[model samples]
Target: MQGLSAWRDDRCLYCDVDLSLPTGTVMQIRGPNGAGKTTLLKHIAGLSGRRAGQVSWASTDSHDDRDTFTQQMLYLGHLPGVKSALTVAENLQALAACRGINLLTHTISQALNTVHLGGYDDMPCHQLSAGQLRRVALARLFTEPVPLWLLDEPFTAIDQAGVRELEGWLAAHSEQGGVVLLTTHHPLALNCPLQFLDLQPIVEDWH
Candidate 1:
């Protein structure tokens, strides 16, 4: 995005923000609480309304061709976004169906196993712990091989081992020519080059 800005109330949360990420790069948006880190991710994902500046994909206007952008991007918000009544496998299946991809039972099983949710497939999402629910949302990374991943606070509620596994996945994705932009407080130990964008409260000058 070029000169991208967002509003929290009537006042601007961030102003004149500019950012760009190339292929095979992992960028972490870092800041203290309410620093517009998540706002930036949502803006880039076209989830929030734009107040200022532009977002483009490969030099093409992202808003003009949202379908193309959506097809190439995978977004996971901080919230699990899973249905409480749905079983673990059913949730993943619903997610795949939304992306127009039909995953087989074996594929779903394997993805759950990868996220360490192997045996919980038949259990309702509400029956699992918070971390497990997050893992259910995370299983999408294994199923959808999109080029761009926008994750907001993806490391929340997960244990150390899950964090390590996710770190490895991020590195592998970058190495495979995928772009990852995420907001997380957890210090990432990615083997690949990891970039950071720190969002601070915009200071205006009155002369």
Candidate 2:
């Protein structure tokens, strides 16, 4: 995100929350509730049409950026976005398909296992608990090869073990030249160094 700003009805909500992230870096966005954390992420993701801002992927600029960004980016929102009718593996398949990925069945199962859902591959998502659903959503981290990850409230309904497991993944991604941008209220224990983007002052600074 570069020269980033967000507004609602012509009133500034998030002002100048610009960021320059390098590969192998983790950027955490933090603030109190209703501080525009999610909205800021949405703007970066190009989902906030009502907001004014310029968001670029790599050094490429806004025009035609979404196509490239979408290709390399994996976005996990506050909602798990899992389809209850689909089995765990099927949901992962859908996620892989989003990036035009084709993974073998065994590979998909292994990814589920990595997320601590070993035997739940063929089980319908509705049969799983809230945390399980979140895990299913997280399984994409393994199946997708996206280099940019935008996660909103990723820790919601996730357990401590899952949290640490995710931190490990984040570290690995950073080490492997991936960029992670996320919003969370919980403090992260990441092996990679993290940069915090506090939205509190950005919110208060808006005029």
Candidate 3:
């Protein structure tokens, strides 16, 4: 699979900017608050309708191939998609089932351990601290292997150590030829070659 072009329309928040990100690359979308970072991520994740332009995947011209695109991508947004009522293990298991990945007990345990949540897997997410919950969310990175990762504000609520662990995981993912597109204000301590896209330049006109 190759990269795709993401174009914007006049009614779109980003106006006329179009970005083409190469495959197997780590693309960072940087901007101030409310600069459409989340919007761009939503579009890439196939959660939002394109106002005018399109996002193509693998050079395929068929819009019916969205499922094909979705299968190759794992999207982690501002919300961890965790249920406050469920245990950490249950949340991961549910997500794995929905994504059609068979998440084993050992895999869940190892993922929690990677995110430093080994002892908290059986606990309710509400019982965990904000940072700990974020770690639990990030633990999915270890349990699942997808080609494209789209994360919005992944560093939110994470401590320094947790941030380091997440960065290391991302670096390793890119090294294994996986592509990552994320929005983060925190300076990343990564060894991989990163491409930065400043979304601030694409301002919307309210007129």
Off by over 4 Å in 3: 1-11, 201-207
Candidate no. 1 TM-score: 0.94
lDDT of 3: 0.79
- Models sorted by TM-score, best on top: 1, 2, 3
Rank order by lDDT, top first? 1, 2, 3
Model 1 misplaced stretches (Cα beyond 4 Å): 203-207
* Comparison by lDDT, 2 against 3, better one: 2
Can you write out model 2's per-residue Cα lDDT over 68-98, one digit (the tens) per residue? 7778788889999999999998898887877
Our model 2 lands, by Cα RMSD against the true structure, at 2.3
Candidate 2 residues lying further than 4 Å off, grouped into runs, are: 201-207
Query: Per-residue error at 196 for model 1, in Å?
Result: 1.1
Residue 61 alpha-carbon offset, candidate 2, angstroms? 2.0
2 or 3: which has the higher TM-score?
2
Summing lDDT over every window of 10 consecutive residues in candidate 2, give the lowest-scoring window.
198-207
Q: What is each predicted model's overall lDDT from 0 to 1?
A: 0.89, 0.83, 0.79
Query: Given candidate 1, what's the lDDT at residue 41?
Result: 86
What range of 10 consecutive residues in model 3 has the weakest lDDT sum?
A: 1-10
